[model samples]
Target: MTKRQRFLQRTRSRLFSKGAPDYILLALVVILVLFGLVMVYDASVIVASETYGDQFRFLKLQTVWVLVGAAAFAFTYLFDYHNYPKLIVPAIVTTIVLLVLVVFAGPLVFGSRRWFSIGVVNIQPSELAKLTFTVYLACWLAKQKQRSGNLKEAFTQHLKTELLPFAFILFTICFLIIVEPDLGTTAVVAFTALAVYFISGTDALHTLGSFFIIAVMGVLGVLAAIISPYRASRVSTFLETIKSGYAPDPWISGYQINQVLIAIGSGGLFGIGFGESRQKFFYLVGNSAFTDTIFAVYAEEFGFVGDVVLVLAFLMFVSRGLRIARNAHDRLGSLLATGITVWIGLQAFLNIAANIALGPLTGIPLPFFSYGGSSMVVVLAGVGILLNVSKSSEKAVFR
Candidate 1:
């Protein structure tokens, strides 16, 4: 055979020799993104037309974000996953700096300064923090694993060496996020970090101790909430909704949650049919119909059946993520996979629960389905890291 033909043959063999990164997971992600684009247009068309004089304004912006996210996904997927540890320090530092900048310079939107407006694009540092913290924690835990001996030694050493730093970093991030008045993101980041710590093979005693620390933090968080009238009002509103089973007035405090419930109930078994949702027409209040409360608008359009499909897609994504973690080639890969999975899954659950009134309105958007550029980019980048890990594991097993 000619040299060029032989080279081509070898390239094909190398590419196809090992199993590819989980195609099922990739397919599910693509489906969700496509579905999100359609829903974003359906939910935002009227508002876009009225506010911006362009019916496709939000749709067009969301399409651009999806393209940006796709590029991020491709870059991360093709890059080596094992090299992420080198990025841990930079990631942590960048997040801290941006968060501080947000406090001082971020644009105020709806009474909170959680986003930096660069011309037309708004960047939420908290979203970047979530992904950065996950990467940092994964690297930290993996290093902890390598440095320690057995379970008992690991536990003792972690307590002696790692506990203080870990607590400091975790609380710093959480404090910054909460001060942004974004309690939902704070909780998600805290929980994701704790999950990574637990899965890092720490002893049972250390795990329990970690939970005790988290509980103490939780108590402090509750006290902080009670001290703030704005937060306390949210608590009261939630309680009132639970007690009365609906908001007392459509124009009052619990109006958003009530609207969400109306949308869900109106969806019935098969939905109101595509872009036919009446709630998006200034009934749901605010831009939530396209952002945090997008799920309700979705249900209103596609019904209970669509809700089930979306839930199942998330479940499948989580399952595939865990499977990748299980078969990962290294401790870092495993922890990174687990952290990303929990971050996305937990956020999605909190958003859905808030929509259905199972939890207080948290203002947390659904992953991949919400209308935000920063969140879409960060989340898709995380998924790229996960796919890279899966690819590495496949290569490890086959070669």
Candidate 2:
């Protein structure tokens, strides 16, 4: 064969050798995003018109963010996954600086300084923190394993020398996030970090110890909420609604959840038809129709069938992610993939649970389905890294 032909043959072999990126995973993401865009428009049109005199105002902004997220996804997907470990330090530093900046100089929206207003875009540093911390922890744990080996002495020594520092950093980040009074984001970040730690082959004793620390922190969080009347009222309201099966004052304390239930119930089985939700017509107050309670609007429009499909989509996404982690090329890849998966999956669960009043009202956004630019961009970027990890998986190559 000619030299050029031989070179082309080798290139084809190499390109085809790893199979293709997880197309099923990619397809599920695309369906969710496209459906999200439609639902965002459906849920926000009236609110946008009332606030901005344009029905498509939020829709136009969300479209821009979706484009930005797509660009982010492409960049991360094509980039080498192994390079992330090397960049972990810089990523953590940037997260810290941004978190500090948001606390000191960021604009306070709704009495919390969680976002920095950057011209037309508002950046949430906490969102980026979740991704960065996962990368950092995964890299650190992987390196420790390499240095220490699997001997019990080595594991103990590593914990003595490394675990304290890791715990301190984790605690600091969690403290900073909770001080933003965003307990929801704090919970997601902590859960993601702990998941990465657990999957890194930490010993059972250490795992139990870590869980104890987490439980204590959780209790403190509940106490903190109860101490604040505004927050305590939310908890009590949720409890009352649960016990009574209805809110006493739909226009007052339990407004959002009540409206969400109404939207969900009004759909019966098949939904009220797309963009035909009655709750979005000023019946649901605040940002329920668009952000916090978008799922309710979606259910109201598409019904139980749509809800089932959405749940299955998320389940498939998680299944694909876990499979990628199991077949990842190395420990770091596996842990990073696992961390990203847990973050997305747990956050989605919390959002949906809160809407259904299965948990206290915490303003956690549904992953791809929520209408928030910062969340959409960060999550899509994480998905890009996940896809890159899948590309590097030995099992993925054959499949």
Candidate 3:
């Protein structure tokens, strides 16, 4: 058999493995999902009732998603993550096809082509990319081996074997996503993949090269935002607000962030109390009180103490995930653990930062806390995969 076929044969031989799951990791995910459901209902009740004539519309829809996410979590948690290499190619193709289809066939919403309308459900291809592309990168990186210790030969070998293919795939996937004008998701995917690649080995050249590529992509994203009319307006608003202290048109241009600040500011020591946020009524961006800005409404209801608790929960979750990565049984498991952990951690940080004005509004979900079925399902699936990796950690490590 050929070297390629041999690699597949040897790698695929370990089809499955079993071990005790990380209960701490499991507990953190459970807490977040349950808390998210409660907040979805609390934040979405007013608008859901007004538009759908049912205060429980979003809550009910979210509950259905939670159930779907549970099944996805269970499947990924039990399945061997080492078997990912056998399926990575097909997964890559599906991810690309879905991304292209969404851009062409999906309805445009708010000037961006990001999701498909499937009979009372919206699936964001960009979100799916977050999971699939990570799997692709982890599998690819796990297979890479240094050709020769000779620095010159090694550099050239790395370029030919790793960097070239990586750049091509990275640019292609990112091109499709940037066309959707979804920079937030693109950044998360790009950085997560880069982390997996860098963690796969300690090649200084590869690390620097990957960082350079992502930096170039970041520059391109900035240029794209500057050129688009709607995105330009956002850039201008962000600059105007940060430089001075207000937007030119407070009620129109700066409304969302203004409302976010208002909600956060009014939520003093103990907050106005649960479900008692006045901003959730009509002050925030109508229905978005439940989506991109849910954190603001959460802050309004729970106060500073609540914010500290939530932040600490996320910190602990990330710490445990990294520990799992450090103790993974194999290269694939370690990189897989790293990729999943970084993806979720970075997305959560971006969402929270945007809410608090630490960064410009990126319209990304707060993982489990956001009220989107696709997002909830995708995130939980990733968590499930992380948990799967944890099962293979150094004997009873986190058990």
Kindly list the per-residue Cα lDDT of model 2 for residues 1-399, writing each as its tens digit: 999999999766755567467777888899889888988899999999988899998888889999999998998899897887778898899999888878888887665788888776888889888888977888887776343555677657756756666677887887777667577788888888778877886666457647765885686587557544566677788899889998767778888788889999988899999989999998877666888789899889889998888888888889999998998988878988999999999888888888888877767789987788999998999999898888878863436
Q: What TM-score does structure 3 among the candidates reach? A: 0.92
* Backbone clashes in model 1: 0
Query: lDDT (CA) for every model shown?
Result: 0.85, 0.82, 0.84
Per-residue alpha-carbon lDDT of model 3 for 264-306, expressed as tens digits?
8889877889989999998887677889899999999899899
TM-score of each: 0.91, 0.90, 0.92
The per-prediction tally of clashing pairs is 0, 0, 0
- What residue runs in model 1 are displaced by over 4 Å at the alpha carbon? 1-19, 145-156, 223-228, 248-250, 394-399
* Off by more than 4 A, model 3: 1-18, 395-399
Q: Give the range where candidate 3 is weakest over 10 consecutive residues by summed lDDT.
A: 10-19
Candidate 1 TM-score, true structure as reference: 0.91
In model 2, the runs with Cα more than 4 Å from the true position are 1-19, 146-158, 226-228
Evaluated against the true structure, the overall lDDT of model 3 is 0.84
